[model samples]
Target: VPKGVILTHHNFISNVRTCVAMFDITSRDTVLSFLPLSHVLERMVMFAYLYAGTTIAFAESIEAVAQNLIEIKPNIMVSVPRVFEKIYARVMDNILNSSSLKRRIFFWAYRVGKKYAARQLQGEKIPASLKLKRQIAHKLVFSKIIERTGGRVRFFISGGAPLAKDIAEFFYAIGLIIYEGYGLTETAPVLAVNRPGALKFGSVGRPIPEVEIKFAPDGEILARGPNVMKGYYKKEAETREAFEGGWFHTGDIGYLDEDGFLVITDRKKDIIVTSGGKNVAPQAIENLLKTSSYISTVVVLGDRRKFLSALVVPNFEKLETLAREKGWHYTERKELINKPETVDLIKSEIDRACTGLASYERVKRIALLDHDFEIEKGEITPTLKVRRTAIENRYRELIDSLYREESSVSSDDFPSEESK
Candidate 1:
């Protein structure tokens, strides 16, 4: 159940002050506001922007963000990881559909850009020759991609979810900066954030001055600060439970890296302990799989099971194109997903994406769904976070059948597939 937070006027003011100074926002900056104002993250940020006298531009809708960006040409914007993931997927899909010569040119430019970005992140001075190559690459390939964001986005602020490391790097290579942050509504929504001159791709930056972070024995992040909410609104028991040790439990599992940057593993409740006793952080794997142009959404599963499996929702647009190119025949969505060619394609994508993961952490079986998970079905939340339990419950028979087939298959045999 979702409980209301009993926040005070001081809560917003303190967070707003910290945000203004933390980000160095000024009157000259204009921010594009897309997230709903009622969300604590957006509310506190709007307050901060207003306090700094920064201009705010309201997006017409999420679907209209691209047009709004071009019109407003704002200096800053904030969004969840989903937005970046879609952009990455769309761009990759287009590249895959382009001519062979264009594909080669894009890849060459991408490599040069990636190398240049890596050096900059390491604080190594760019050589003049490499700098010249980077400029050419920008003009040849990245400039077009950059134009989609209006060519003037100073930086983007990502919150509400963890931004995938690959997506962050890709944006950097294309001359865009995504500063991912971590927070919750109860904390007035600002904890740690990546800022200019103090950048890291994969990790959320150090905790803000107002908030204090610590970890529970199980690695749950706990926070104590003036910005923390007083308690749940009229839910005293829940409030007491949340602050059992005088620290508000964040329920997120993460740790501070060597550089003091926070690296979120997964949600404490979502950690899967297999029958073999190996603990798996599903979100990281799920995020990795989502980077594939073929996968629209996925949920990794194997709680107390022999091996990991997944429920995949294919990017039908890409899938159909692949089918057409390969001469695969299908009359409808269901028939399309079950075709041997389609199954093999998705399986290959899963394997390609998880090549670096340990054996147990990798998905060993998959069941493909023709349609994406829907909020109306309770398979995903409004923000697109998968509702694992709800999904598993709804697909229990299908999921169980996967492991059942797994048990019968020889151990030496590789992964299996199912279609739903």
Candidate 2:
């Protein structure tokens, strides 16, 4: 439905006030603003910074965030999960491509750091031996990773999408905390956020005092708060639908955990129900795949189908590096992606990432997309979230072929019922 949301000054003010207090933003903090200013999250965050008298630094572009981070030395930054994913991917790429000794050392440090972080997150006291090991891990590996973020970052705020749990843990293990939050433009935009000393890796934290969050029987998160808009512009039907049952309907499906923290699974509409009567979260699978350094973007699709498949955009830079190492001739992107070696590489990555996934949830096959989902192509939103229906429709032929008998991806190829 086409609708312009009407938000008042009071809505912005109340939300901003709560967020500022939660994050403890003050004049001493510097924020690197790179996400589109028109985005509700960025704009609302801008207001919060102004309220806190914080210093705001604008990057020349998203591509320049790394250089800008060094130049600005921002203490606090906010971004969507996409930015963090890229950062994680880049770091992993470098580590994986390094020498055998260096790789082993990095992994050892990572293990130690992760163990330390897990203990800290559980509110358990760290033993003297583990504390010493953590310090060594920071000096040898974590310090170098932190240096890329300007070494002054106190923490980062991730919203707009769910940060991959592994990525969150990796950063936290290295002493860079990502406090993931959950909200929407319709709610002026924040209902819950993880604050210092109350953060959880996967959960979005307890609901803020400013807003109330409940759920429908099916687990669609619902809210009715002063920050929520009264109605949509010129769309009475849509507005009524949004405010069905007297609550602002957030189409996101999630649940409150035992500790009162919010955990968003996936969007209600994005849930894929396969022919096997399995309800799979596409975003969960997509996020899991994106954790691989070789994959840049992926869209999982199996809605009303036999099993899961995906359209994957390979990280060409990493692919080219692999090609160079393998002595495989690769000049053009299309030609390189067509090679059997590349396909096998991606297949292995998918299989590796889908290790713990159930048979119904595992993506059995994927079509290698030469290009990524783009805003100009209407395949992605301004916030870079994939427009699933649009992409599925645009690539209908390719998708259909994946399901055809000739292209019937073997049940033995991946983790499936037949494999066991």
Candidate 3:
């Protein structure tokens, strides 16, 4: 699809109509579309572009997004949270790896900008002291960074995953309004989006016009609006299960704030309750762990138990690089993990990540695995989601050994312990 064209199934034309009417896009607008046409988000956006007579430039592939963005110099770009995270990480890495004075100045400017942005978002009138500092930071640091966003992007929208509050604020402070929205493939994928001048941090903004959002008794988000899909394709039973009464029952667990903003807590199915009667959301802990470059995968465990623990799979490549820099000899993954010094280093890193978590949700002990869990190993889904049940079963022995203080040696050294 190229400028002024739409690519989508006819069944979803209604959603396209809604988007076109809502965004008020025009022929002058250019959209660099690349998300799969089959997906509701891409389809809806593409159709909306056509309805507005807007120009659409399709990227060759996901890898070509940067080059395409530069070529297209799009006015709007919509992407999943993962894409934004990668860009943020790469930018931060570059800043950190710069010269000492540049790194310090970059961080100093970031802090000043963040404070100003936070105050503005909270509706606290900016003080003169902060206002002046923010102006300097914007000109000297933030503006240059924003220019790298193809120099023409006016709005950046994030969906699919929870956008970290810090990342959102950082971008906003730097003059980019990264609007976080909430929806699913079932709901034409755009129930609520933050509009210009009406944005809110932390919460997904108010429901879009014509969209009705409400909460279920169990905190599941429900929607009743024109954007709602007709039903599942050729699956009446499944479709019926999706809607209760008149609202589409979104399986995600979340709540609408007093101001009518949506705040997702976790998935209802992903909540874990410990034996001590403490409820924990593993996703929160997992998200924190992933902030560390060393930690590639983390599964927090304490369900029906006294305390939380974890099974971690380190990013071996990053760890090897660090080990070499620190003058440590690295051999096998297990050997590196079992090293007392390395284990302590990981413990400290995990502790830092879990600093703000509730005591019950904090990981008390960690066991590093030799390899990452993957779908091929029957430990993950094809979509790269963790197969919690399979992982728990496979690591049952190691988990049990971690809880047993009587064991003097590592679980791998004891056949009985390893066999479980």
lDDT values, one for every candidate: 0.87, 0.87, 0.74
Error of 3 at 54 (Å): 3.9
Tell me how many clashing residue pairs each candidate has.
0, 0, 3
lDDT of 1: 0.87
Candidate 1 residue-wise lDDT, 1-420, digit = tens:
769998888877888898788788999999999987888888888998889999999999988998898899899998889899999999998898799998998998999999999999899999999999899999999999988888888899998877899999999998999999988889888778888777888888888886889999989999988888999989999999999999999999999998888888888889999999999999899999999999988889999998888888888888888888888887988888777777778878888999989999988888888788887998876666789889999989888877766657542223323342
Ranked by TM-score, the better of candidates 2 and 3 is 2
Per-candidate TM-scores read 0.94, 0.95, 0.80
- Score candidate 2 by TM-score against the native: 0.95
- Which of 1 and 2 is ahead in TM-score? 2
Count clashing residue pairs in model 3: 3
Ranking by TM-score: 2, 1, 3
C-alpha-based local distance difference test score of model 2: 0.87
Which candidate do you rate higher for TM-score, 1 or 3? 1
Model 2: how large is the Cα RMSD against the reference? Answer: 3.4
